[model samples]
Target chain A: MTVTAKIDVKNQDISESIRKLLEDILKTEIIQAILVSQHLPMKKMVMPTLVTDPDHLDGIDPLAPAFPVNAATIAARLTRKPIGEKIAAVLRPCEIRAFIELVKLNQAKRGNIILISVDCPGAFQNKDYLKFAGQNPKEATLRFYKKVMDGNAVEVEGVELATACKACEYPVSENADIQIGLYGMKTDESILVKAQTEAGDHILKQINLSATNEPAARQTAINSLITKRSSFRDEMFLKTTETTNSLEKISSFFASCVNCYNCRVACPVCYCKECVFVTDAFNHDSFQYISWAKKKGIIKMPTDTLFYHLTRLTHMSTACVGCGQCSNACPNDIPIMELFRTIAHVTQKAFDYQAGKSIEQKPPLSIFCKDEFQEVVGIND
Target chain B: MSEFEPTIVAFFCNWCTFTAADLAGTSRLSYPPNIKIIRVMCTGMVDPQYIIKAFLEGADGVLVSGCHPGDCHYINGNYKARRRIKLLKEILPQFGFDSKRLRLTWIGASDGIRLAEIMRTLVSQIKELGPSQSKLSMVI
Candidate 1:
């Protein structure tokens, strides 16, 4: 049975309450470690940390409103092999989805892990997070949480949340074992936590928290957020599709790409031991470049940018979770996510597939039905 | 430009479609000579990259032929190819290339006449569509 519980809040510090919960969880012999974002003494940035000791949980900050990396990659690393013990990981919705994709792809195993996801209030871009965070990130997080939880604009000093976050529709994770909910809850009095899986229920029993039913207001709040984000997502898809619906336009759309491949690195589901783009196949002969230049009069110096993206589109669209990390990592500030999400939306729909929807759903390419897409094979009756 | 003849790239599977093309040649069956056949082990082995590369390299049309359903030498290779080609067709139109430029056909080795007829039909379709824009680019 799904168990709903509360972690009472003190001093109106949501992050501190979360940290205390993690510390309590870590202090037990139940989970060997808890994966979370924590402030290190060396830098102001909150990086993913594996807290084996209860003392280390003091720096835990899942509400920092800064996403430097998709923490699913970290979770995948922790869960890839049999590490002999389980780990509790606090992640965002996208991260859990990406981790699930990794598990499906055989990049990670699901045995020794418990996914703890949050009601993502969304995050700012890396630089913008630093600027908005100012001197004390803890206070900034509290303020950020207060603003977003109240359904106000999450903008700080004219800066706003990252485009991916603003365009995000899936703010609550469905695949997580435990879902921490700050949305539509009286956070100053208490925070809501739902044990979404058997593992989550077991953990709540161990913690000795009283059970409660999911509040009706939580559902209403979540519905409104989804409605707001879906409109944004559809508008983005239409704008991106219109601009990139042709070869010349697609080329021009990616014209600013220097082929640095930051998007590939940032992509969570783009797990290939040897990427086709990095192989000797793309390394053209020096004479071939000169001949191509001679033929076209003047070709783009760093050619194959469009080809690289198209190849990725063909490969990963079925697995893309629309996390917006590609645009987040682009050095040239290209809205790479918009194009990918646009095409992925169409491609997935054509196959009647949703990438990373659940572990039970097989990837579209990996399975097939006898009667799907008959028009492509000219089988019209 | 008035006498434009489309250069078609045909990826024929070694087991079924390749033999069918060979049978057509042996039987002296007449078909368009525009096709440049590249033999592959199976249709499943035909990467979507090859199709994209063919278009990028200025092929007016592409035809991928393999054994009919339940006749694949590799059990379900043709089924996999069907799904991949279907998705490829769906995406090419978004990039301004007509999905008609690519065709996936099923021709058994015994059906040499069907193979010839399919080739004629594909060539005529391209003739109606005119040369692909990839071949008519100002730089190309």
Candidate 2:
């Protein structure tokens, strides 16, 4: 049976309530540590930190509107090998999805890890978040979530959420072992907590919290958010398709790229240990460069820009979780997410598959049926 | 303008299609010379990057011919190749590559005439499609 409970809020401090919850979880004998986003004392930036002591939960800020990096990579690292202790990870919805993808790829194991998620109100880009969190990041986090939960305007000081977040259809993660709710609840009084798995139920049973029924408004609010986001996503797809429908247009779309490869690095599902772009294969001889230039007469220097992007799409589009980290990592402010999400939509649809949707579904290229996809084979047929 | 002779890059599986090409040669079958054959151990080994590079480097068409289903020497290499092709067919066309430019076929070793016939038809089909847009324009 599913266990639904609430964390009582005092003094209107949601983060504190969450911190207390984490501290309680950490205090449990079953959980050795907790992985969550926290503010580093040295800097205002929030990053994923592993906390073993209950006292360290003071810095926990999973509600912080700062997504510096997808913690899935961190989760993968922690759970890649058995550490002999269980770690509870507090993650955003997209991070949980990406972690699920990593698990499917055999890059991570889920044996000793419990995934916890919150109803994501969305996040700002890195630059915008820095501006949003001027002096006190903790206060800024509270302000952002309060406004969102109150059904007020999301844009504060002319800055809004990231495009990926705005277009995100999944504000709630159904796959998480435990979920914290804020979309349609009286946060000033209490917050919702639900256990989705047996492990989550076991943990919830240890904590003394009053059971409650989910409010009807929660599903309605979630539906409205999804409707708004899906419309935005379709519009984005239309615009991206118009801009990159041809090779010449695609070249112009990525014209500002310097081949820094930050997008691939930022991608959680791009699991290659050694990308061919950085290998000796791409280290062409001087004569080869000259010959290539001589043939085209005016070839773009730092060549293979288009080649690199197309190759990446073919290699990783099926696994792309539309996390928007690629656009966040680009120095040139390229809308890399728009193009990737657009193409990924088509590629995933062609296989009737969705990336990060389920653990049972194998990756498109990883497994294939003998008689399937016959439409793709042969010329006359 | 003179009649267009499209340059086709054919990646044939060594166990099947490559042997068919060899059989065509021995049988004195007259196929179009526009095709440049590169024998791979299996069609599954023909990475998507190979097809993308050929298109970018000015090949008008690419063909990945392997054994028929269940005839794969390495079990299900051709099946894997099919999914990759289906994926590329969805992506490359979004960037203006005609779905016709990329193909996957199953030609058995003994079907020399069938292999020769498909090549003639492929070359003609590509001729109808004209030169690849990437060939006429600069790609970097």
Candidate 3:
């Protein structure tokens, strides 16, 4: 079991307290910028923010229920080539998992960044968040925290949390240097912080937080959250699988796709610089159209829509983290996340691999294992 | 009406299908003149996007002919191609294109008559289906 320590919350605001903590880190020569969640000044929306100045930490709002984007891509960009100084990045559990996948892909380096993850209480989708925040964002945030901390379901404008968040199995970050504990705790007085690594232990030691045992109440809270999430995920799997089990059904399910390719751009892990779809390779001449129409009678406009998606599935299904950003980014509102998650569930299971689970495990496709996929490869016989 | 001559794009594997196509010409066997053959090293090397591109480029239909299963010069290239093209056929109809427009067949260097037969059938099928209207070029 992991040990946790408590940080007493004085009468100070949560954002201000977090800011002070970051400021202290900046004072140390070893630390560079502190990547945190902050509310934008114009909109009361909270998103991942990178703070270089101690003074700027005042805007940090990790508690706000707005996650416009995952911070893994940001971490990937930061550590791509390296910037001399070490930085501390606060990420959600999913983001940490995503960073793990990115690192495995050689898109990110782990040498410089300190990963701090908090127990995710789940978050609302973008539009639902705006509706819930209506007129008074601060009050909404406080209410949200209260409801979640009190073990009540947090709803935004009568809508439940995003399907992805509701079904997420990992609420606590498995790969964090430092972890912020929120579930099963007294929110008004204090919250727990646990260090999972040597680096984390060093940071916690410097901060001098009072040590505490893992509270029984905290375990109960975590169990309840995980139970709820698992049930939701199972239901989601059943619902999606029932909708399309065969190739014909699957094809029909995506029949409305207009080939907009929004899902591709929305996927953070889809790091291809030049997509095959957009290249000159897909550019067809006019006469070819007439010839095909003359033969086939009618060909769908925006040809190769199915091919484009299938190709992407083959390429990225094994790495899919089920962020639901693909569905969120679609203008046509296609249920892309459902299709991807369903396929990923099957593909990943076949390889006994879950994407973004661990940095140590390499992507199955990148390695050649003679004994792997024996059933599918028909090599077992 | 003008004689219906379907414009087909044939992606022929260099070692087998491409050679078979050459054999057809050298053997003085007559076949449909609709096909415009492009040589590739292996069927596995053909990206599904290329087939889609051929359709978009005004080709009435596409024929991807490679060595028979387990007979590929590259060992398992044809098998991989089969899996990819099979998946492509399953999923392509969702985007509104007739998945039938794309055909995958295994043709050996000795099977010049089989290659000619496949082309003749493809050309006739395409002639019945008419030209593809989904080509983005037609809109502008």
lDDT of 2 by residue, A346-375 (tens): 999998888888889888889988679888
lDDT of 3 by residue, B73-131 (tens): 98877766765565455444434446667788878998888778777777878788776
Model 1 per-residue lDDT tens digits across residues A172-241? 9998888888888889988888888898778766786766777889889998988888888899888888
| Model 1 Cα interface RMS deviation (Å) | 2.6
Candidate 2 has an lDDT of 0.91
Predictions: Cα RMSD each: 1.8, 1.1, 6.2
Top TM-score model: 2
Better of 2 and 3 by DockQ: 2
Proportion of native contacts kept per candidate? 0.49, 0.89, 0.03
What does the interface RMSD come to for each candidate? 2.6, 0.9, 8.2
What local lDDT does model 1 show for residue A68? 90
Task: Please identify which of the two predictions, 1 or 2, would achieve the higher TM-score against the true structure.
Answer: 2
The stretch of ten residues in a row with the least summed lDDT in candidate 2 chain B is B131-140
lDDT of 3 at B104: 81
Find the candidate with the highest DockQ and give its number: 2
**How well does candidate 3 score on lDDT at residue A4?**
66
Model 3 chain A: ten consecutive residues of lowest lDDT? A372-381
Give the per-residue lDDT digits (tens) of candidate 1, residues B28-135: 999989999999999999988889878876789988999998899998889999998988887888888888889999999999998998888889888888877666
Clashes of each: 0, 0, 20
Deviation of model 1 at A42, angstroms: 1.8
DockQ of the two-chain complex in candidate 1: 0.54
lDDT of each residue in A49-123, candidate 3, tens digit only: 888888888767677777778778998899898789889898888888888888999989987788988788778
